[model samples]
Structure formats: structure tokens, C-alpha cells
Target: MIYCGLILFIAASIVHLAFCALKRNKAADATKVFLMPLLALTSALALAPRLPESRTAFVCTLCALGFGCIGDVLLLSVSEKRFMAGALSFFAGHIFWIVQYVFSPNGTSAYAWGGRMFFFIALICFICYGIVLASTYVLLGKPKGVMGGGVIAYGGILCALNFTAINAVVSGINGKAALFYLAGSILFFISDGVLSYTVFKKDIPYSRFIIMLTYITAQALLAAGCVLPYG
Candidate 1:
């Protein structure tokens, strides 16, 4: 079932990207709507056998992916209101991902030595994220209102998600899963950065294709991280 869902997801993603490249908005959006749900379905099926034991993680994973699906649909609109709503949905999704990591049996239990190393690495990464966030906010013309606050808040949560993902890796609770989580989080961050720059700064070549490509891949990796067995 998981493999079936994954194959469908890849097919949808390819179709969506092709439509995006061809500048077919309607076709692209039609395909885009299924991307997250397919990934969520894949994760759900993967976690099914582990049920009872993985109840919390399963719930969190589904909720996160559910919110991603909502965001995907909401973002299809051209209105600012819808865009903000979509951002909020995605923000909620990030929170759920963070919560999943916090509660997972194989999450966030760093060894003393690894904890210290992670602390330093996290500090540097957070600093870098901060700079990028600030710069992007400025590039967006320093939006002065709810949108401004929302952007800052969203960026902060994204940083937290990335931070938590890195901790998962250094904790050594589940090496393969943690690495997938870390990579997914990083790609997600990059996707958002590219998206914001394209929308608020200036048009980038093949921006839509680039955004959806990274976004869907990130979601797939994150789903994989959640469903893969812990070591």
C-alpha cells in the first residue's frame, strides 16, 4: 500500500511539475492537490503495522500532512488573504512536525557529548537562518501589519523545525530516519526561501517548477522519516 501510494505521489508530482513548466495553471493545481494526501496516505500505510505503539507519532504525522494538503489548496488562490491562510496552515503543519519529534521514542535524546556538539552547530545554523529571515523580510518591503508578524513567526517556527530535526540526527535514536528528517527540513526551508523570493522580490526562472519540486520532495522525505523503523 505504501509503495502504491508513493508511486501515485511521484506520478502526480511529475504531472504537476510538467504542467507548471508548461504554464498550465489549472492543470498544475489539479495535480498539486493530490501530492500531500498521497504522501500522507503512504505514511499512514507504512505506520499501520506499528499501530498502537506508534499512535502518537502516527497521529502527528497525519495531522502535519493534512495541514500540508490544506495549505496546498489554499495557496492555489491569487489572493493575499488566501496566501496568508495557506501560510498559517503550513505553520501549523510545522508545529505538528516539531511536536512529533518531541514525542517520538527515538527523538531528541542526545548524549552529553552529542548534545554539546549539537548545541554549537545549532547555534550557528540558527544564526544563519536568522540572517536569511531578516533579509527576506526586508526584501518583502518590510510588510507592516499582520503579514509582517506572520512572516516572522513563520520563519521562527521553520527554524525551530530545522533545529529539532538536527537534534534528532545527533541524538542517534534512529540514524537513517533522523538523517531523512534533517534533509527534508533543510529542503523545505530552501523551498520556502525560493518561493518567498519569487513572490515578493522578483520572478525567477522556472520558479513554480523549482518550488513544487523541492516542496514535494521535502514532504516525501519527511513522511519517510516518520514511517521508517527506528534503530
Candidate 2:
């Protein structure tokens, strides 16, 4: 069932990308709506057999994917209001991921690494924040007003998520899962960056193609990461 769901997701992504290439906006939007749910279903199928043992991770993964679906739908509109709502939904999703990683057994193991590990985590976060700050200034120029403040807040959370994923890797709590989380988080950040460039700056040629490609793949990997440790 899990593999079946993944296969469906891949098929949907391919169709969506083809529509994007052909400039079929309506078809692409239709396909985009299914992407996250399929991924959620995939993870749900994988986690179901584990039942209560996987309860916390299961709930967190679903909530993250649920918000992702809402964001996907809301972002289909061009309205700034819709966009802000979508961004907020994704922000909530990231928070869910942070909570999952922090409380999960794999994340809990990092405490034994003590001060040195925390120092490294803090350093990585600092570097990520610096990168985000520089990128915002260079690429998007200075943000203004409510949207600007929202962007900054979102960037901070994103950096924290990336560093947390990196900490999971450094902790070596669950090797494959940690790698998946780190890769997914980095790709998710990149996708958002590309999206911001397209929105606030000039649109890149085929910007939607690039954005959705990375976004879907990042979601898939994150879902897989959520399931792998328990599986």
C-alpha cells in the first residue's frame, strides 16, 4: 500500500510537471492538489501497522502533510491574502516537524551528546540565519510592512528547522532517517527561496516547474523520513 501510494504520487507529479511545461494551468492546479495527500497517505500506510508505538510520529506527520495540502490549495490563487494564508499554513507545518523531531526517540537521543553537540547545532543555525539574511537582502531587497515581517519570521523558523534536521544527522540517532530529514529540509528551503524569487523579484523562466518539482520531492522525502525510523 505504501509503495502504491508513492507510485501514485510520482505519477501525479509527472502529470503536473507536464502540464506546467505545456502551460496548462488548470490541469496543473488539479494535479497539484493531490500531491501532498498522496504523500500523507503513503506515510500513513507505512505507520499504521505500528499503531500506538508510532502514535506521536504518526500524528505529527499527518498534521504536517495536512497543512501542506491546505497550503497547496490556497496557493493556487494569486491573491496576496490567499498567499499569506498559505504561507501561514506551511509555517504551522514546519512547527509540527520541529516538534516531531525534538520529541521523537531519535531526537531525544541527542541529549546524551551534551554541550558540544548543542554548540555545533547553534553554530549551524547561526550560519543558516546569516545565509537567509544575506539572501533576503541580495535577492528580494528589503521587505516592507506586514508581509516583510512575515517573511522574516518564516525565514527564522525555516533556519531553525534546517538546523534541527542537521542536528538529527549529527546525532546519528537514526542514520537513514536523519539523512532523509536533512536533505528534505534543505530542498524545502531551496524551493521556498526559488518561490520567493519568483514572487518578489522577476519570474524565472519556468519558475513554477522548478518550485513544484523541488517542493513535491521535498515533501515526499520528509514523509519517508517520518516513516523510516519507525518502520
Candidate 3:
């Protein structure tokens, strides 16, 4: 039943993206855009694996992903380009995932390692780098137009934070888990990168289609990663 729902969900999403891409200005239908992914997420959650070792963290991550779907919808709605709100929404969602990780074995169940702290520090530095890039593009005079670069900045950091949490839990040793997260992250980046370029630069390309496709893949992978077998 769950797998069937997943298949239906993906089919609906593909149709949604195809329609959005084939028709211009039709991408503004936030309701249709929002519903498909939310359904996919709901169905995915139903099939999530229950593991004694990381059940709580897995559940929390699912919740964060749920919130993230909402964030994705809001990002689509901001026709005027309110980057800050979109960023804050996603930032809140990412923080929840961080909370989930912080409570995980590597995060809270075990002793802190210098290596872990260093990883976080480096991650923070990377976020700072993205912020600088955003400022240079948005804060300066070189504006893209409606797609505020700030939104991209915040979105990038949010993704990075989520990735950091994933690393904390997955440890980069497990092939499936790592690959799932990596693929999801890449898809999300592709989606948002297209959004930023389209909105700010006023470049009209078929990127929205790619964004929809990649976003769906990212969420699907996230759900799958959460359900990996536990020994």
C-alpha cells in the first residue's frame, strides 16, 4: 500500500512539473504544486522504518522534511521575491533536523569528539562563505530582479545544516545512507540554484521543470534514507 502511494505520488509530481513547465505563468498555481509533494511526503512517512537505535531521530527528521515541503511551497509562492521569509522558513525547518541529530547517538548519546566539533566549525565557515556570496550579489547593487539572492543564501545554509545533521547520524561510512543523502542534497541544490538564477537574473529557461523533478527526487530520497534497514 505504501509503495503504491509512493508511485502515485511521484507520478502526480511529474505531471505537476510537466504541466508547470509546458505552460508559462501556470507555475503560479501554488495549491497544485504544494499538494503533490505533501502527499508524497505523507505516503513516504507511512513506510518509514522504525529502528530502536535511531527511531526518535528518524521521526524528527521526517517532521523536519514535512516542514520543508511547506517551505518549498512558500518559496514557489513568493512572486515578488521575499527572500528573507523563505529563508527563515527553511532555516527553522533545518534547525529541527539539527535538533534531531543533536539528540542522536553521535550528537548526544555519545561523548563529544574534537572531530565532530571541527566538522561543525567547518560547516559554519561554509555557511559564512555562502552568506558573503549572497551579500556580494544582493546587498551590493547587482540585483537579479525578483529572485532575491538572499533567499538562495538562506536556502544554501539550510541545506548545509541538514547535510551536517545527516553526516552526524550517517557518519559517511554507510554507502546507502550516504548516497541517499548526497543525492537528495544535490537535487535540492539544483532546484534552488535554478530558482535563484531564474528569479534574480530574469533568465527564462526550462529550469522550473528541473526544479520540480529534482525537488521531488530529493524528498523521495530523504524518506528512503530514513527507512534503511537497521541491524
Candidate 4:
């Protein structure tokens, strides 16, 4: 049953991407509505029986995926506020991820590795990544203000998520979960970056495929990450 669900999830996601590439707005919009929900359901199905680190852990992961679902719908919306609303949703979702990580015993494993060095490295990387993003926004004529602040905050959370996820892997605790989560977060980062570029800057060739490819893969993998058996 779960495999069937995953298959359906993949099929539907591809259909959504196809519609997007075909420029069929309505079809694409309709398909987009189902993508995240399918992922959420699939995640639950895969993870529910695994005896996750804790019930709260699974629940938090579900909440994060659900938030992404909300973001997906709003982002598809045509209104001016849709993008901001979607960004907020995703930002909150990332927070959920951080919450889950912090609550889990293995979540802090990254901090244990290499002592303060990892922390300093993560801080530096975060600042550098933010600088590049700030430059991109400025070049796009989206200067520092309300939008800028939101972008920075969101980016920081996302970077933190990736950093912790990668740390989860390095700590050698629950390698499967850490690996999947890390891969998904990286792809998620790419997806959002591409999405912002598509929205704020000039369109890139094959942008639709690139964005959906990364987006769907990110969600699917993150959901999978949450369900993997904990150490």
C-alpha cells in the first residue's frame, strides 16, 4: 500500500511538472494543489510504523510537511501577497524542522562533533550565503527593507536546517535519517533559490523543470527522512 502511494506521489508530481512545462496554467495549478499533500500522506504511511525516535518527532515532521503544503498552494496563487504568504509558510515549516531536531537526542550530535569549530564554521557559511543572497536581491532591485529582512531570516533558518541535518549525518547517529534530511534540505535550498530567481529576476531557460525537479525531490526525500528508523 505504501509503495503504491509512493508511486502515485511520483506520478502526480511528474504530471504537475509536465503541466508546468507545457504552460497549462490551470492544469498545472490543479496538479500543484495535490503535490505536497501526497508527499505528506506518503511520509506518514512510510514512517508511522517505524517507531520513530518519538511520536512528537514524527508529528513535528508531519507539521513541517503540512506547512509546505500550505506554502505550495499560496505560491501558486496569483495575488501579490501570495509569494510572501508562501514564504512565511515555508519559513515556519523550517522552524518545525529545527524544533524536531532540537528535541531529538541525536539532533544535537552535530554540536558535539569538533566542539566549537563546527559552530564557527556553520556561522561563517551562514553569513557568506546570506551575503550572496543579499547581493542577488539588490541586483534584482529588491532592496533591503521588509522583504529583505524576511529573506534573510528564512535563509538563515534553512541554512541551519541543512547544517544540523548534515551534522546528524556526521555524528554517525541515524545515518539514514540524517542523509535523507541533508539531501532534501540542500535540494530544498536550491528549489527556493531557483524559485526566487524566477520570480524576482529574469527567467532562466528550463527553469520550470529545474525548480519542480528540485522541489518535488526535496519534499519527497525530507518526508522519507522523517520516517527512517532512529538510532
- The TM-scores of all predictions, comma-separated, are 0.93, 0.95, 0.69, 0.88
Clashing pairs in 2: none
Give the per-residue lDDT of model 4 (tens digit) for 144-190. Answer: 67777777777777787887776677666566777888899899889
Distance from true location, Cα of 32 in model 1, Å: 0.9
Candidate 1 has its poorest 10 consecutive residues by lDDT at: 106-115
Instruction: Give a tens-digit lDDT track for model 3, residues 206-228.
Output: 76677667767776665454444
lDDT of 4 at 171: 64
Instruction: After the best TM-score superposition of candidate 1, give how far the Cα of residue 145 lies from its true spot, in angstroms.
Output: 1.1
> Which of the numbered candidates is closest to the native, going by highest lDDT?
2
Which is better, 1 or 3, measured by TM-score?
A: 1
What is the RMSD of candidate 2?
1.5
Best by TM-score: 2
Model 2, residue 57: C-alpha shift (Å): 1.1
* Candidate 2 backbone overlaps, count: 0
Error in Å for residue 183 of model 3: 2.1
lDDT of 4 at 166: 67
